[model samples]
Target: MTAPDLTRRLVAELVGTALLVTVVVGSGIAAQRLSPDDVGLQLLQNSTATVLGLTVLILLFGPVSGAHFNPVVSAADWLLGRRTRSGLSGAEVASYAAAQLVGGVLGAVLANVMFEVEVTRLATTERTGLPLWLGEVVATAGLVALIFALARTGRGALAAPAVGAYIGAAYWFTSSTSFANPAVTVGRVFSDSFAGIAPGSVAGFVLAQVVGGLVGVALVRYLHPEVGEAAGDVVVPHPETRSPS
Candidate 1:
C-alpha cells in the first residue's frame, strides 16, 4: 500500500489530538455544570463522553495517521521497530510528537473558549503525591501494552472501541484519573476545570508516563518477540511514510 504524505500524516495527528482534548475538556466542563453537587456523577458523564468521542476520533483518523494521539505511543513505535525498520523513523517520531503537543494546547484553548472560560488560565487542581504518580505509571503502561498487543495480534481493527473502553475504565481504576497521555496532560494544564491538571504536577505525571511506556515496551518485547514488524501498525494500521534510514 502506498503511504500517505508526511504532511498529511502530521495533519491527521494534529487534528486527532486536538479533537480528543476537546472532547475531554469540553465534557468535563459540561459535567461540572450538569452535576454541580455530585463529583462521581460528573466523572461518569465526562468519562462516557470521552469514551464515545475517543472511539469515533480513532475510527475517523486511524486510516490516515494510525490515530496515535499520544506521544508515548509514537515513541514506542519507533523503539520497537527500530531494528526492523518498519515503524516510524526518528524524524517522523519527533514531528508526530510536536504536532500532538501543539494540537493538545490548541484543543484546550478551543474547549475553554467554547465553555466561556478564560483561555489562558493555568489549572489550579493540585494533583500530586505518590498514589497519583503510581496511577499515571499504571495507566500509561497499560495503555501502551494494550495498543501494541492489539497491533501484534492482528486486532488493530478493534482499537477504536477497545482503546476507548480501556481509557474509560482507567479513569475510575487509576488514582490520577488516568492522564495517560503527555500531550493531554499538558493540555489540561491550560484549563482550570474538572479535567485540568496543575502545572506543578505535570513533571511527575509525565515522568511516570515515560517510565510506564518503557515498561510497556519491555512487556511487548517479552510477550510478542516475533511480532516486531507490526510496530508500524500500533493503535491502528494507517498509511505511513517510512523515512529513509
Candidate 2:
C-alpha cells in the first residue's frame, strides 16, 4: 500500500503531539489537587488519560500522518528503514520534526499558563538521579519499540488500544513511570505539576529517550525482520533518515 501524503502526515504528527502533551501536563494539574502523596494514583490517572487520548488521536490521524508524535518514534521509523524512496521527503521529515519540537514547546507553555504551573526543576538541573534518568531511557525505549514492532501490522487503527494498554501497564512496571515520549517530556518542562520533569533534567531525559529510540529500533529490526516492506529502499527525502512504507 502507498503511504499517505507527506504534508498531511507531518501535520497529523504535530497535532497528535500537541494533544498528548496537553494530556500529560493537564493531568498533573488535576492530580496535584486530587492527592499529593499517591504517586500510583497520579500515574494511573495520567496513563489512563494518555491511553484514551492516544487512542482517539491515532484513530483520528493515523491514516493521514502515521501519528508519530514523538521524535524518537520518527527516528525509529527511519532507523528501521520503513520509508521508501517515494515516502516522505527529507524536507518533510525535517519540517515535521521541527513542527513537533515547536508544538511540544508550545504545549508546555500552554500547560504552564493554563494550569498556573511553575516548573521547579528543568532538565538536568533536578536530581531525578542517574538511575531515574536511565530508567526513563529504557521505559521510553520499550514504548517506541512496541510501536515500531506493531505499526507494520497495517491494522494500527484497531491496534491502538494495545498501544494504550501497554503504556498504561508499563506505568507500574518501571521506575520512570513510562515517559516514552520526547514531545511529552519536553512539554512537561512547562509545568511544575506532579508529573512534570525538572528543566535541568531535560537534557539527560532527551538523550536517554534518543538512545532508547535506537535501542528499540535495533531490537525490533532483529526481532521482527518482517515488520514493513519499505525497510531498506533508501530513497529518503529527509537528509537524516528514510520513510516507513
Candidate 3:
C-alpha cells in the first residue's frame, strides 16, 4: 500500500485501539462494582467481555487496519518484513505505535468519564515480581505466535475467534491476567480499576513483552520457514489491497 493507504490504516488502528481500551477498562470497572466480594467472579466477567469485545473489534476493523491493536504486533510485522518489498515501512510502524499509545490513553480517559470516575488517575494496582513478569513474557509470546501462525498457515480468517479465545484463556492461565498489548498496558495505567497496571510496573511489563515478541518471531521462523511471501495482512485478514507492493 502507498502512504495514503498507510494513513487510513493508522487511523483505523487508532480508533480500534481506543475502543479496545475502553472495553477493557470499562468492563473491569463494571466487574469490580458488580462483583465487589468475589475476585474470581470479577475476573470471569471481565475476561468474558474482553473476549467478546476483542472479537467484534477485530472483525469490524481488520479490513481497514489489519486490526493490530498491539504495538508488539506492529513491531513484529516490521521486523519480519524488513527485507521484503511489501513489508511495513519504518514510518508505518512508527505511526502505528504512536496512534496505539495515544488511543490507549484516550480510551482510558473516556472510560473514566463514562463511569463518573476521576479522569487520568494513575493506576495503583501493584503488579510486579518475577512470576508475573514471566507470565507477561509467556502471554505476549503466545499472542504473537498465534497471529503470525494463522497468517503463515493461510488461516488468517480465524484470527478473530481464535485470538479472542486464546486471550480469554490466557487471562485465567497466565498469572498476570494477560495484559498482552503494550498499548493496552500503558492505557491501563490511567485507570486504577481491575484492569489497570501500576505505572511503576509498566517498564518491566513492556520490556518483557518486547522480549516475548522476539521469542515469538523465533518460533514463527523455526516453525514456518516458508512464510516469506506477503501472506495477506500482517496480523489479521483484511480486504485484499490491489496497490503495488
Best by lDDT: 1
**Candidate 1 deviant stretches above 4 angstroms:** 243-245
Whose lDDT is higher: candidate 2's or candidate 3's?
A: 3
Global lDDT of each candidate: 0.92, 0.66, 0.86
lDDT of 2 by residue, 116-232 (tens): 666443433253677767777778778766775555544444446766787777767766777777777777776666767777777777888888877877777677776544332
RMSD of 2: 4.7
TM-score of 3: 0.94
What's the TM-score of every candidate structure? 0.98, 0.82, 0.94
Residue-level lDDT tens digits of model 3 in 1-245: 33337778888899999999999999999999999999999999999999999999999888788899999998887776665534466777788999999999999999999998788579999999988989999999999888888888888889999999999999999989999889999999999888888999999999989998989888987898755354346667665433345
Predicted model with the maximum TM-score:
1
Off by over 4 Å in 2: 1-5, 82-89, 118-127, 153-155, 228-245
**Model 3 RMSD in angstroms:** 2.0
TM-score result, candidate 2: 0.82
Better of 1 and 3 by lDDT: 1
Residue 227's lDDT within candidate 3 is 51
